[model samples]
Target chain A: MPADVTALELAGLRKSYGGQAAVREVDLRLPRGALLTLLGPSGCGKSTLLRMIAGFVEPSGGDIRINGRSVLALRPERRPTAMVFQSYALFPHMTVFDNVAFGLRLRATPRVEIADKVRRALALVRMDAFEARFPSELSGGQQQRVALARCLVVEPEILLLDEPFGALDRHLREEMQVEMRKLQRQLGVTMVVVTHDQEEALVLSDYIAVMRAGAIEQFAEPIELFDRPTNRFVASFMGVSNLVDGIVERDGEVSFRFPGGARLPVVSDLPAGPATLALRPEAVRLCAPDDAACRLTGTVAFTSLVGSRMSCEIKVGETVVTALVPRHGSGPAIGERVGMALAAEQLQLFAR
Target chain B: MRGGAMPLLMLPMAVLMALFFGAFAVFGFVSFLQPASGMPGYQGPLGLSNYLRFLTDPAALAILGETIVFAIVVTLASILLGYPLAYIMARSPYRVVRSLLLGALVLTFLSGSINRAYGWLILLGRRGVVNDALLALGLVDRPVALVYNWTGVFIALLHFTLPYFALTVFGSIRSVPVQVEEAARDLGAGPLSTFFRITVPITVPAIISGAALVFSLAISAFAFPLLLGGGRVRLISNYIYDQLFVAFNLPFAAASSTIFLVVAIATLCAFFWLEGAVTRRRAAKRGAA
Candidate 1:
């Protein structure tokens, strides 16, 4: 695949609205054929950053490169990129055929070619039979499919989506997520999807860029991001994380000491100093008193019988921590004394 | 839903309609009675001679032609001029400015025709400010004749009808959400392409309605045409006026008035038919989709 050369590069992108910085000095790169997601909360700069790349928004300062060529000054159409809007801005007046063929028609492509390409794009999105339907006549998921078809038919070097499935119901959203990942992989198109949903990011991205207040906090593969988030922000934003205040002792081991005189030994190369220890809720286990590890003794604050798992909230001092246990297992009852132990390798220690 | 209100609401309006209809029926019957040549009152047998004369009159034919042509021209002019303005109004960034523009449009139509034409007369007449400016700028050697002609009539008609077209078009354009435009552009379309292919097509209903409104307004206009067209241009209304006032032929004039009324009513029916066609086509397209 020639290692799929860097398809897009953003160097210090910046944007502000009404003196409020929406995005600031953000930099990232996407490899060819890679599906990268900008994941963060609502107020985060994920969508703004995506807009800058899509040319709907101009960066206050920075350069955008595609295929090692500068494209910062290019208009949206001039640049070889297409965007799927969160609202699925399909042309309500146009038939599905025309909407999908819009870009080719703009380029003055031949009629027969446009028809062929539109059909192919529609097939890719599994909407081949809906070519004559207007956007308003379609369901939400169908509109989203047509939107995808429209962008795909353009055959752009990079495809961008801004929370494209945010309007879909949960089941449709999950289905579209799977459909999108499959289509992107099948076409080997370099794609960027902006989403606030962490699970959507996890499921759809090969690489996830966790954004925070106008900046890229961490960029890595999904597993890399989940396993080793460089900062507390990425770790906490990505999933349910239990953060413990701790101090690094000698060697590679660390100990988290709470106000209640409970000490937990953890694994980290972080130098001897005050730190915050983060571990995924799934990484901690409910253990018997004889089981040895970094244990925290607390009363079960709450318990929820989720479909496949029993989620128990354990209280350590005044801080409430959650642990997910297998559904059939015997778990601690609410208000019962319990001891939770963190696996050594699962603990993430960040220098405070 | 209110107490003792249903009958009260219907009674006053029903009485008024009955009175109005009764007067129309009486006058219309009187118009049909033949007049005696030597007598001071109607004495001849009831006949259709007056109606026959009205239908065959050359002057009536000319007035009808003038009315139709005037209506078509003004409607076309309004549509051509109002569309861009409406588009701009719809897309205006400032709500205050948009509201002010709409308010100005309302102001144009609120005043009587006599007032509006008088204002135009001062601006468009020879030796008026516009002509003075043109003369001073050396654009013309003499003051151009602008008032009391077809050109002046057209100007007044356009001014009256333009605001109507603008408001209707504005409503249509504003109803089309911006996301549709953004979607088109995001699909790799340039701004111009997005507008013509998407935004313009979506607002076709507005354009149709605006044209219809301007046409209806232009056809019935009496005050402006009478004031600005002078005697040289005799529309149906002016012809009817001349028959009743100058000719003093009440039967002939009433017959002519009835003919004109029928024609106006017919034209309005045709306009509605055309709207029906457009709406039906739109509905069919939506159903097909």
Candidate 2:
């Protein structure tokens, strides 16, 4: 294998079950040491795509190459890939040391080398002291750590994770995510994570492949995915709620006009036609109804303090415009009148 | 569903236990009594005469040894025949195959044991179906001696217990999630290694229980031995039957029955002890983790 070759590649990956395609035409190239997340809602073929890469699910039409070598014909264990199952399928009968040493023993590795590798892998995941413990004795998060050590001990070419932290609580999940990110960086292992949580995807991935209906919607950096979604599905799926449907026009400067006399000038090169204006909730600054910078005015229908920001749902005529403002500075009380000013730099337009 | 009904249900269970326990107490008392004198009005003073007779007699010792051997052999043979079937029932991909195999097994179990033994007798006897086929195919010069012997008794007992062993093992195997096995494979274990290293140890408790059940059943078996043994291979149960009914030696029968009860309880207790050890280890493992 060439040094510069991609660590894992899926070319024209297609899978169908009983005449219905589960994943279709998904092509990906993951560089060594880069964490890529396949982000999608459940049943969107994201898990299927990850399983295909792991060689657990055989593709109906595709080639999965690891480090420039095709592994399509290889079994899951034979592939240079390991997966941390979502259920953290740790063996209940074996201690953590034996579980981590299982792969090495399968290859008939020397007994001393197996013990050393198992210990190093456990220490990498900070599970060194828990080696004698069985999985049944561990918490969900500790079980996941052992699972990671079990996979990492093999020193696989790539590690596939299927919602690895989905079982933990909010605080523990965040803690584990940071721990896993640090471990991944320290070891420099290419990782492909499958998750439905966009927040998790953003926090952990270098790039995200947003999938919908067995196809990739957008494959880009996390910031690019959040800030510049390519289509209406991507816009709504990314949790950007201000997707105002309207038509684009060239009146000296291109502007969009919606029903109820609402209009906004869109700085875009889109041809004059119907389009959707997407704005992030945080991109809208709140103002008084009489403020000149305010483009829309309405009474605040709902308000909640989220972290350091106040999330307000302002009823701008028929539309509910969500605006996040700092909680310290006059957070909108329920039923209070407020206005929204859109940030032009953060605005995105897509064809309806 | 009322809790009150629980105590009511126990009433009948208590009565049944009292009835059997009282009879067993009478048997115990009888075992300590002398053998019947010329008169049944009163035997000699209470003594361990029948117990001494049983311990010192070579014929009784042979019957006891044969029972243990029969139990061990049949238990092992049943496990060897059952574990694969159990694994297939638990892990087979096709629903029809698993259901059909289980259906046949359950159906065989539902059929009376004596009927099944007779069914086998018709198949394995000198002029039975198996001999007929072998002779028709010219595979044997003469009909093999399969029935009216220890082989017949062993085969019949295995047939009676195999479904039992397989069912228990199947439940144990099913209790284990498929992902655990897949995890073993994902961690680089091949199919054989996964089964031996992962599957077998996890299901050991079930295997032990199945072995205990088969052993106890085979040791105390009467119907299969009576019909199949054909007076040639008498087990402890068959000998006890003769001691009580044919020889009219009630004290000796009572003495041997008490020993039989002790042996059965001991074997089952050993299995339960093993099961508890496995469970405790699992609990300790979980607590440590």
Candidate 3:
């Protein structure tokens, strides 16, 4: 394969069941040795798209090319892609070694070479010592590791996983997410992971494709997606809690006019009338009501502890904007009047 | 609720067990006695003469051997035909197909054995529907004898046993997750390979159980042999019936029944043992690999 050829390319990929679309016009191109994540909520078609790539699902209209060659006509057994199911569908009768060796045995690899490859694969997942145990005897996380080894041992052109850590507890899920990222980098295998957890996607993916309603909402790096989401849905999905609907009037200098007669200067090329401003919770700061830089004034309506920070919901007229501030000495009391400061560069404006 | 009521709850089961075993015990005791001449019951003198006659008589031993061999063949044939029926019943995507297969099996099960045997007679007789078709098609110059022989008995016994085997394995096949089989395919195993290596091995316990049930049913059959055998395909059950009714030899019949019971129990035990060994060997095979 040429160096310029992409590892996986999907163009206009779509699937519909009974005339109802499950996946619609999906297009993506992933270079070799990169990890991409399809991040979305349940029923958002992320898993459906991954299954299409692995040849388990047939596309109603689209092209799926592995290494720049169309693989639409191949069967699942003939495809070069492997999938780790959400349920970690390991054969319960087979031991870990045999489970990982299943693909090699099917390919008619020599006995000695199969043993070597299986051992190496097990060692990669840190499960070499438990190779002789059945899947029923292993814990959830251990079975997940074995599932990964089973896919990796075959050296698939692209590895796909559907909600791989959905079964693990919170603590173990985080640990495995980081470990999976490390292993992916170590092997430098092109991989696509589907997850509903944004944090897991951020921790593992080199590029994230945020999806909603069977369409890609945004595709960018984690920092880029978090810092600058293009739409309100993407903003909300990326954990931006404060969205203020207002009007923009460009009188010599552009400024956003709030509902309660509050005005704040903003930088935007959008010739706007009605618009929405997405502000990160951490970007809003609380200060004395009479502070010189105070752009919006409100009374503290609610306060709650969030780890090392205090989250306050400030009521400005009928709209409530949340601000996350460092917890210092119980923070601001409820009913206290406060002024909210907004960061200029952090403001993302979207035409409503 | 406590220990006080436990024995009372068990009293009905105890009574049932006593009645069942009490009859067998009486038969066993009678097997050791002497048959009274010109009577229907046994006499007082105790001896092993009945067992010795059954063990040493070549003609009687041949019937026993033939019955055992026939049962084994019927059981194997049932599994070969029934597993595919079960797989289709559990896995067909069409609701109408699954329902039709289940309905057919249940209908076969609900019908009386003698009814099914007579139905087979009408289908497989010399001038029956099958032979008529063959003659009309010019495949056979004359009507072929398909009844009143071993073939008739075999066909009737298979019809009687197929439902038991298929229904027994149907639930087990359904319980094997579809994703597990898909995983095998995703790992490069073709559909047939996946079925044989994954689906079949996973359902081995159910297959063994189904085979055991039909094996017992086939070995102890009486009605089909009597109705279809026409006195030529006499099995052990018919032979024992003749010994008791025709010859009025109660002691010898009791002895034969005792021997049959022991053999059937041993065969079932061996089937269960094979199932256990298969599962255990699967686990132990990991070390060697």
TM-score of each candidate structure, all chains considered together: 0.91, 0.92, 0.96
The models' CA-based lDDT, in order, is 0.82, 0.87, 0.92
Of the two candidates 2 and 3, the one with more favorable lDDT, higher being better, is 3
Which ranges in model 1 have alpha carbons more than 4 Å from their true place? A245-253, A271-274, A327-330, B1-31, B35-46, B94-100, B245-250, B279-289
What candidate 2 gets wrong by more than 4 Å, as runs, is A1-4, A287-308, A315-317, A327-340, B1-15, B37-42, B273-289
Q: Rank the candidates by lDDT, best first.
A: 3, 2, 1
Q: What total of clashing residue pairs does each candidate reach?
A: 0, 1, 0
DockQ winner: 3
lDDT of 2 by residue, A1-352 (tens): 1335588888999999998999999888888888999999999999999888877788999888998999998887788888999999898888998899889999999999998999999988888999888787789988999999999988889998999999999999999888888888888889999999888988898779999989999999989998899998888888998888878988898887765556777789898998888888889888777888877677899988899898888776667777877786667778988777777788899887
**What is the fnat of model 3 with respect to the true interface contacts?**
0.65
Error of 2 at A31 (Å): 0.4
Give the per-residue lDDT of model 1 (tens digit) for B38-134.
Answer: 4434545778888888778776787788888889989989988888778778888889877887788899979778998998899988978899999
- Positional deviation of A6 in candidate 2, in angstroms? 0.7
Supply candidate 1's per-residue lDDT for B119.
Answer: 88
